[model samples]
Target: MQGFFHGYAMNGIDAKNRVSVPSGYREVIEARSHARIIVLAPHEREPCLIGYDQAYSARLYEKLDRRFGDDFGPERDDAARRQFGATEQLGYDDNGRIVLSPMIKELGELDRLAFFIAAGDTFEIWNPNVLLEVKGASDPRLARIVRAQIEAKGGKA
Candidate 1:
């Protein structure tokens, strides 16, 4: 609970585009916000969906304010407006699932399945095929970094 997202999970998308949030991630979100709501947005530079709980979203808002300042200029206003406009506050259903909007699904190229990749402060939802391609083509340095991290943690690479 103290750390950021740190694992991966895959869940099926039903005909209605509903996918269950991974149970581990649900625990983290519930512990942080005591609610089953998450803010989701298409990644600005990736073919995936990014998600954050309420607390993290607030932190991001603060960061944005600091970066953009509290001025009334068009530049600042447009940046904030565009970012906010692209995000959606999605509430989980009784089954701990959320329905992905058509736009989100299309943006990620999500079809029958979603691959959840844990990022530091946010998680990403990806199309399984795209994730496979990305992993297959990832830089060799990334593999070295992962091996180093595992070795540092006393695990064999």
Candidate 2:
């Protein structure tokens, strides 16, 4: 999984809403996509953001095409529009930090910290508290990870 996202990290978001992308994810982004860029989009059914390399974004587009063959209906149009419109290409700086825009921040309600969990080709950026409210209790394993990270950051577990 050298070139795949497979870990978790939490980083402090600065006053300017910039946070360093975890080093491991940076490595995977470049290795798999040939660029130090991240494609970010609001998660379809979550109050979080989905981040991945450009390559994966292309793959997702192709997947949509395959899934909607010969169907030029409003449903397909809406799906493509939402998926593509929300996606943003962000370039990390020398220190591997990207500035989250107001819209991006609003999408996840991100504040002090950025919580990340890698899921294969994509990683999720979440407001830890929201994640807990949405997923924690129902997902014991994930709850443990999120709780430990929160407590490690001086937040109540």
Top-TM-score structure, candidate number: 2
lDDT of 2 at 58: 84
Clashing pairs in 2: none
TM-score of each: 0.81, 0.92
**Tens digits of per-residue lDDT for model 1, 63-156:** 7889877676888778777667788888998788999889878977888777787887789987756655566357565445444544554444
lDDT tens digits, residues 1-157, model 2?
2378989998889999899999999999998888999988899999999999988888888988998999989999998999888888999999999989889888878999889999988999999989989998799899888989999998886
Candidate 2 ranges with C-alpha deviation above 4 Å? none
Q: What is the lDDT of residue 34 in candidate 2?
A: 89
Per-candidate Cα RMSD to the true structure, in Å, reads: 6.8, 1.7
Worst 10-residue lDDT window, candidate 1: 142-151
In candidate 1, position 50 carries an lDDT of 90
Model 2 TM-score?
0.92
